[model samples]
Target: MKRVVVGLSGGVDSSVAAYLLQEQGYEVIGLFMKNWHDDSVTISNECPWLEDSNDALLVAEKLGIPFQTVDLSEQYKERIVDYMFNEYEKGRTPNPDVLCNREIKFDVFMKIALSLGADYVATGHYCRKGILEKDGEEVYQLLAGVDGNKDQSYFLCQLSQEQLAKSLFPIGELTKPQVREIAARMELVTAEKKDSQGLCFIGKVRLPEFLQQQLQPKEGLIFEVDADSPVYHQEQPTFASQEEELAYLSKNIAYTPELGKVVGKHQGAHYFTIGQRKGLNVGGTKEPLFIIATDVTSNTIYTGQGNNHPGLFKKALFIQQPEVHWIREDLKLKAGEKMEVMARIRYRQPLQKATLFQFEDGMYVLFEEPQSAITEGQFVSWHIGEELVGSGVIS
Candidate 1:
C-alpha cells in the first residue's frame, strides 16, 4: 500500500480526510502541526493549540493510524510571523495563512513526510488537484473546490507544479455540510468544533495588541480627504503604450498632510490598512470614514468619507517579475503577450474578469471593473476556468 501523511489539523474537515484516506486502502499517518507557541497574543478560551493537538490525537486513535505532533514553531515564526511584522512595518498587509501553507506546510512539512517514506502529504483544504498531459509530461493543476461557497484555491495560489504533484486534498469534492455529516457519522471529536478564525494553527488574536508587542506605538495624525479633492481632478495624460497606460492606472495616489483637514489621531499608521473602516474611533461624519492610504514614513493615516471614495479603487495592479509565480508553466505568457483570466486579490473574493499583460520587467492585471483595496504585499491569483494558473504579490 502507498504511504500517505495527512495533516490532521484537529478539525472536522481533516478528521474526515484521514478517515476517507484510510478507507481508500492507503497506509496513512496523522501529523498535527503545532505552528504557534505564544498564546499571550492569542485571545483567551479560543482554539488553542493544546486543545487542537489533543483532538488530533483522539482522531488518530479513532482511525487506528499512527500519529505524532510536529513542532514547527521556530520555522513558523521566521517564515510567517517575522515576515508579517516586516510587511506591516512597511505599511503593507501580508497574508500569513497563505505564507504558512507555502513556507511551512508544503515546503518544510512535505520534506519531513518524504523522509518518512510517504509518497504524498494530504490536507483538508477546500481545493482540488487535477493532472494534465502537456508535451508528454505530467502537469498538475490546482483547481477550485466543488463547493463554491467554501472554495479555498486562493490560499494555495503560491503552490508550484512539484508541490501539487505530492499534495492531496481529500475533502475538495465535498461541501462544508457534507464534510460535517461525514464527521458526525464517524463521531470525530472535532465534529461540532467551530472553525478557527485566527491565523493558521494559531488561535484568534487581538491584532492591534499582537502588533503592539513588537511594533512600538507612535501617535500619528489622521486626515480626512474630501471626495472632490483637487488631487482627484488631475488632467488625464496621453499614454505612449498599453504598458504605460497600465502603469498610470495602477499607480497609487500620494497623500500629504495638507491634502485634507485633521480629523483624528491614531496610535500608529502601520496598524491600519487600506479599505479598513473599524478602529478609527472618529465620529460625526455624514458617512463613515474609511482608510484609503497609510504612510508609515510620516506616520500619517489618510481617510476618505465613504466606501465610494475614488481613492479606494484601482483599475490595475503591477507585479514584479521576481514575484510572479506560475503553477502551470506551460501556460505562462510571453513578453508582449496578454491573456484573459479570472482573478482575485484576496481570499473568498468573487473572481473578477481581468487581463494579464506580461512585460520584460513585470506583469500587470487590469480588471474590467475597479477593485477596492488593491493592497501591496498581498497575493493576487489568476485562474482559467477552475484551474489556478498563476499568482503574484501586488506591487
Candidate 2:
C-alpha cells in the first residue's frame, strides 16, 4: 500500500482530504504541523490549534489511520515569521502563506514525511498536479484547483518541481461545498469548522496589531497634499527614481487647498507603502486621499485624489524568479517577449493576462495591459493555462 502523509490542519478541507485519500486505497497518515503558539502572540479565536489538532486526531481515529503532531514552531518562526517582519520593515507587503507553503510545508514537512517512508505528502490545498513529458524528461506541473473560487495556486507558486512531484492535493477537484459535504459524510469532527483567515500563522489579527507586538511603531509624520498644488503637475517617475524626486518635492508637495495653507507632517518615506488610503491625518479635503508616494529619507508622504488616472493602476509587473513547470524544455526568454499567461501579484488577487520578459541581472518583467500596484517585496506568480510555472518577488 502507498503511504501518504496528509497535512491535517484540523479544518474541514483537510479532514475531507484524508477521507478521500483513504477511500482511494492509499494508506493515509494524519500529520498535524504545529506551526504557531498561543502564548507568544495573540492568535485568532477561530484557529484554536490545540482544538484543531484534537479534532484532526478524532478524524484520524474515525478513519483508523495513524496520527502524529510535529512541532514546527521554531521553523515557522524562522522561515515565515522572520520573513514577514523583514518584508514589513522594508515597507513592502510580504505574503506569509507563500513562504509557508514553500519553506515549511514542502521543504520541512516533506522531508519529515519522506523520512517516515511515505510515498507522497498531501495537503488540503486547493491545487492540482500533473506529470508532463518535457524535453524527454518527466516534469511536474502545478495546476489550479477546479474550483476557481477556492484555487490557491498563488500561494503554491514557489513550490519546486521536485516538491510538486511528491505533493498531492485531494481536494483539488472538489468545490468548497463538496468538501464540506464529504466531511459531513465522513462525520468528521471538523465538518463545520470555519475556514481560517488573515495571516498564515497569526490568523485574523490586524496587521497593525501584529506588527506592534513584533515591531515598535515609530511615530512618523503624515503629509497632506493640496489638490491645486503644483506638485500635481509634477510627473511621477518610476520607483527607481522616486528617492531623488521625494527629496526635492517633500516641502513643496503639501499645500492645503481649502485653507490655502500647508498642514501636518509625515514620517520617513520607507515607512509607507503604495495604495494606502488610511492613517493620513491631513484634514480639510472632502474627497478621500490616497498615498501615491513616500519620501523615506525626507520623512514625507504624498497624497492624491482617490480617483486619479486609471494608468496609476498599472497592469504590467516585473518579476524575478520564473519557475516553468509544465514546459518540458527550458525556455529561453528575452526582454519584450510577450506570452499570454495568467499572472497574480498577491494571493487574494485574481490571475490576469500578462507577458513575461527575462531582463538583465536575474530580474524578470511582467507586462500587463494596465499597470498594477506591483509593490516591491511582493510575490508575482505565473501560470500557463492551469499549470503554475513559477513565481518571484517583485523588486
Candidate with top TM-score is 1
Candidate 1, poorest ten consecutive residues by summed lDDT: 194-203
- What lDDT does each candidate get? 0.94, 0.71
* Clashing pairs in model 1, backbone N/Cα/C closer than 3 A: none
Off by over 4 Å in 2: 38-40, 225-272, 278-284, 295-299, 307-312, 320-329, 332-338, 364-366
lDDT of 2 at 103: 94
Clashes of each: 0, 19
Summarize candidate 1's per-residue lDDT along 1-395 as a digit string, tens digits: 98999998889989999999999999999999998888899998899899989999999999999999999999999999899999999999999988989999999999999999999999999999999888899999999999999999999999998899999999999999999999999888889989988888888999999999889999999999999999999998999999999999999999898999999999999999999999999999999999999999999999999899988999999999999999999999999999999999999899999999999999999999999999999999999999999999998
Residue-pair clashes, model 1: 0
User: What lDDT tens digits, residue by residue, belong to model 2 across residues 54-109?
Assistant: 98899999999999999999999888888887777666678788888889999999
Question: Where in model 1 is the C-alpha error above 4 Å?
Answer: none
* Model 1 lDDT, full chain set: 0.94
